[model samples]
Target: MTRAPAHDLNAEQAVIGAALLAPNVVAELAGTLAPADFYRPVHGRLWEALCAMQATGQPVDPIALAARLADSGDLGKVGGAPYLHTLIQSVPTAANASHYARIVADHARRRQVADLGVYIAERAGTDTDVAEIVATGRAILDQAAAGSQWSPLIPLGNRRHLPDFPGYVLPEWVANMVYGVAEFTQTPVDLAGCIALAALSTAAGGRAEVEVRGSWREPTNLFTVVVLPPGSRKSAVFAAMIGPLLTAERALVERTKPAIVEAELAARVAGKAAEKAANAAANADQSGRDTLLAEATAAAMNADAVTIPVLPQLVADDVTSEEAASLLAEQGGRLAVLSPEGGIFATIAGRYSGTPNLEVFLKGHAGDMLRVNRRSRSPEHVEHPALTLGLAVQPDVLRDIADMPGFRGKGLLARILFSLPENTVGRRKIGADPVSEQVASAYTANLGALVMTLAEWTDPAVLPLTPEANERVLDIERAVEPRLAPGGAWGHLVDWGSKYTGAVVRLAGLIHLAEHLRDGWGKPIQAETVERAGLLGDYFAAHALAAFDDMGTDKSTRYARLVLAWIERTAATTFTKRELYRGVRSQIPTAADLDPVLSLLEIHGYLRQLNAPARTGAGRPASPSFLVHPEVHGSAGTVHGLPGWASRRPA
Candidate 1:
């Protein structure tokens, strides 16, 4: 047997050359001609078969090559005979002959390397967590999958390093330029088709040209079109999609532009008209004011006397008809003042004295009048009242009153005034008091109660009314301050209730305080603070009642039983079993009492024993650590201490 020369046995060159030739062999040179030459699929198949035989320590066989090709299913797909012959022709070239066999061996080795599985297993005898290793491995796989090199495989002929068509750029290359420009300009390009076109045009070294033209008359059915390179079938496809869209957009702008311009012009015209009208109205108002002032002066001069009516009786009575006319004529012709409240009394000069019988005069008269009064020792007091006529009752006074800063209304002021004991005195004398000191006190208490009620409801809009209601609330605050014990009114109220009542009040207070912290102050209180404040104990009591209310019968007693057991277990940790039992039995004399508290505690997890000590004979062995579970803590997990309750607890 003749051995191949050393020059005919290079490995690296063979591998590179084979890799280069593999695609051509698969595409153009596979199976059209003879078989058995080196570069042919059959040769590669035979070499692979030989390597497989070597690995298994078996003899090389042609049947094995045929079997391998049958199994791989590549022979029919790669032009079967002609492709094999063409590939085989390349095997005898002098440059390839030296490296061919070694290259085949190297290919087998490379295939083996690629096929070898890279599995990760936890290290043996190490304390490393398997979960952590698995997590890290998954993360590595994810990162590798995200990189460009790890991509889906395409068919041999379909893969290309350059553009397939002449004068055309790859879509990805054009997209990159478009995106790069968008990024550089910092302008968003949302139209995907337009962007695609722009990218294509940019890559082709062409500009996106536009033409604008105007006519003396507005253009109708206006449109725009983007002309693309001639004979570029791909460009034509892009133009077909993007051309109409851009044309429609331009047409819409042109159509709407005239309407927008007209609207702007109309707005300016309306503004000018409004300015002229405002100036005319101003002049008219000034002229009216001057005329009214002059009329008022002439009327005052004509009246013999201007006496404001002291009371309504003065306007209600009538004296002589002729005397009434003389009184109206005496003081430069002014009319008598009218009073809605029968309080104002007045005298008319040169007519009826001491109070005129104004009932007859008031019956027939319906015109503007005036009430004049002499200044008195007390500037606020109205005295020496007389009636005058022809004085215009200007609306400015009411307008001024309405415009006054912080003037709520007369009724509101009266309500506030009547709330005071001093202001209530006059009404009390008349036996017509509507609101007394007692009523005010009740109102204050009700205000506090309402605040507590609102807190329980978790309504936030309540606090905004504080500015308006603060003064009224302050009155209640002052009255209640002396009655409140150290903690506050809320604390005193809770500590003073009966066992059942105390539980209810405390629970209600807790609900209120929780809501106040959340809605009023926008914060949550801490659990430790609640426990220290004795709120937890109250919650335990309340929760028991709530559970009882829900369960409604003895069948519902299961939760209560669980809570009691937990509490007993928990109590066993801190006190002697007898002492703990005694204290519980005293507070809860009936099984009924024990059941509810227990149920509530269990439901809330507050009564549950955690790390409880084992029971010893007659008493607990030692002080066991106590764990008060969270359910008794409520949502905010805070228990506010009642006033005087903590300090009064037995040591």
Candidate 2:
């Protein structure tokens, strides 16, 4: 038989080429793969650079990359620009990325198996703890499947190269504003801070009142989540950046507080007066009573129509679904939930366990009408409620609530822009230089302007995209949909991608409004605006995928992982089904768990069944057995841990 050394150079080249052609797909592709997984030395280097660029929010374009590679003195390593060109033109389209990815991954597994055999052979004779050796082996398997593994995200600094936020540079005006934030806070400018500010500004413009669509319409409201560990300065950054918007909201309430109170008191007084007059009228003569009662009834109607303009409260931290709806209704169908507390998730999860009230929150995200009818209470109805939600929970807290029902399947969690940055704590200096007053003042003043503009926007127009901008919307769809197709590399995250295109348009509207809220739109939907939104979508999807992975890892895959660990720990290959069953019964527990996991191993080519009659007495039947692959299981003729396998296992 013709044989090769467990590597497919063609598959490696195909994967590298796919990425070179469509760099935007890097995040999803990178999740399950790494540089070391590549068989070719040059291909490994190329992948490393691709990942580096992607991780740093940098473009992976050829011209830019050629210059970078030349600077790093490694352009000659991969045969320079021509090789990159070859890789780009290797495949006809990126649609085959999943196919190429699978082929490359399969070769990577073969390579791993080859190396693992040598590793196990050497260690088999060592005096090391068998459990420790097995643990090490399981860890190697986990690395092979990083895309589906679940583990703690601690020592945040190590996450520096995890994945990148949107690499799209902000518009000069917006960039200038964010620059001021970084300058004053003396903190690394988290793009999320700016994203949060923009989302809130747009929310205030009114999600309920507007739907910006291309060929289709979607709610203007957005759900934003800036995920990071506690003490990552999310709260401080958000508080500062969002401070002006909140201030304007508070100022509106304060300015209108007196008038609202006066109107309410007047209504109460009018109600009492009407009641007294009715009582007196009841005791009077017929004509007198009728006239008095008429006057009192007219007064009551006037009082009823005199609905006091409620205080201009637009942001809420702690509130129930009913109250949030009431606020949305009262505040022109716009409100934001900005909180550092994790309770926000629980509230969204539901006040009581087992029974979740997610429909209201889901509707709020969709800008759908919410009508609450209670048997014992006044019904509350909102035709369109725009709820802009922002939460910064620690990573651990995120994992805890990830399993909440309806979070993934119902698309509640999928509709969010999730941002998780590497920790920057140790690098920050005590008593760093303070931000100059001018920049800080400008930052706050700019937000104040946005908030004021929002306040003045009594009936926020449902802005339509300009013709060219509408084209860009199509472009965004074209760009995002291919990746969402079934059997695509990103198929696992298609649900998240489903809402992503529209969300980008809504965000484009927000960015447009923020920059040119003062001046009339030159063209409401600029190409740059849509492009920026696309970049943000890409960036946020990276984080969202990472977060969602913890929640949606398949159960059988998880059990398969556990089974692999046990097999590795035992450090042996051939054994009767019952013997292996006894060893793992505690964790695997029942036949249901064991059977599927064993099958999974077989499907993955790690194990296979052996058909044989037992050497035991005639009455003793042939119990089932498995032939674990050598290197993974043990040498074919020599089963290390099980003695019966030496005689019974087929040579």
Candidate 3:
């Protein structure tokens, strides 16, 4: 009394019949369904023939298929001419061939899994090392169970269509580089544009604050994160945008080196003189000791007063929150953390001490007073710290960090501007032209000049808004303030929406400075520049809404999304819980972990769990399986805000 092999006779016949009746169905299922997926030997033979005929430009009607079978000497073995007609009559409609093919493939996978299980059991019973047995077992199981967790591509309920980046809003030099990098790398301009603002922030962060209104000012520093999937070539975009800042930092260091050397030499000589005076005071008579001690103290004070400036450090890639604070103090209260990875979030989430250390980042973005007191070392303090953040990371990081202890609770997420750029992975043109030398040179020179020029400001320059600009800023504030009410459009995002106008003001400052890079101090920001910043603000607002919504998704929903991505890739129509768990074991560690994910998927209309057959005899019942929606294999519209969404073309 053994169980029959896992397969579906009806699905096999239906797929064969559909391929014979309509050639187009064969083309649709060609990628996912192979001849070996059919349960019956004759059906597999006929499917192979039909595929071969299609490949060779031959028609695949019953008569033509029979002739092909005869040529291959498989006609008599396949039950001859009558069986071909029978296959054609089995399918009621050819349009359902993809659905039938999925069924066939699913059953084939089930049979393979069953055989694999038997093989593993036999190996386990052998006189072999347990590690060897487990290793070999996992390898074969992974190969067989690769794609069972796949769910159909469907939009989550909270997903929103994001606005395109307002590349036109940037100044000509900035826009030229944004578009040029976009063209060269074939990525969205949003990435380069956001980074451009961050670069600008690095230059002018602590140097200036834009006065929005009476006693209301916004710092030029910004925290911007662009979300893209892996393989989007984000690093290339970051390097191209951040290269100028690195060059300018080196130039600034070189320009200020002589003064630094002079100050350092003076401090050293004063310290040596103070040491000699202290020794002389120790050996002097009681009356002279007091005078010599006073002199030594005076010399030590002069040495401390002759402070040597720290070398100009404009950017840092990886540093802990404490290190960032020290760098800010060393560099006149300005620092930018620019990276292509989002590991900074983990670092900020207390990766070292297991306690959240967000005081530096929290105060950095707000331009608040930051003081760091340490034992046995000089304390570090900044009257107005301006820390800029420019990061490009995979979208999943947003979901992952949402659960960190104080990331959202402390308003860290709210303070940053998020951009969810469209991923252009598979459609990118190979051997695309590189950025033109003229555009590249102009961008490098202009951005470098702006950074260096702003670094010279010893005091915060108030970039005043024109009368028209002031009115527009007021209007934006008014419009946004009401939406933050309890039942308004932005009620759920009060923290983020409350800071929208401030972000706009900061953007306006960056735009104005970029427009007049060489002589931006004491200048008024025009209404047009504010208007462009407002548009850019709107773009970020839409993306933030989408990003926060995605970040707010529960663990089960996120896991369900991973499952769905697998389903769409494999086009799987049915599977058991054990099967799905094995396929997604990395994300979903155990079968128990998959239960809630399956329930969520079922709620989202991606799957329906079928009841197990009534128990026969005293043995345990079989595992329940899910039936995937038929439309999963059909022409569903594109799903945005999900993993693997199609990338949009260049704007």
Instruction: Provide the TM-score for each candidate, comma-separated.
Output: 0.15, 0.59, 0.66
lDDT (Cα, 0-100) at 232 in candidate 1: 18
331-355: candidate 2 lDDT, tens digit per residue: 7777887776567777767764446
* RMSD vs true structure, all candidates: 41.6, 14.8, 18.9
Candidate 2 structure lDDT: 0.65
lDDT, candidate 1, residue 437?
Answer: 43
Of the two candidates 1 and 3, the one with more favorable TM-score, higher being better, is 3
| Cα deviation of 81, candidate 1, in Å | 24
Give the TM-score (vs. native) of candidate 1. Answer: 0.15
- Report how far off residue 517 is in candidate 1 (Å): 62
lDDT (Cα atoms) of all candidates against the true structure: 0.29, 0.65, 0.81
Residue 496, candidate 2: C-alpha displacement in angstroms: 1.4
Ranking by lDDT: 3, 2, 1
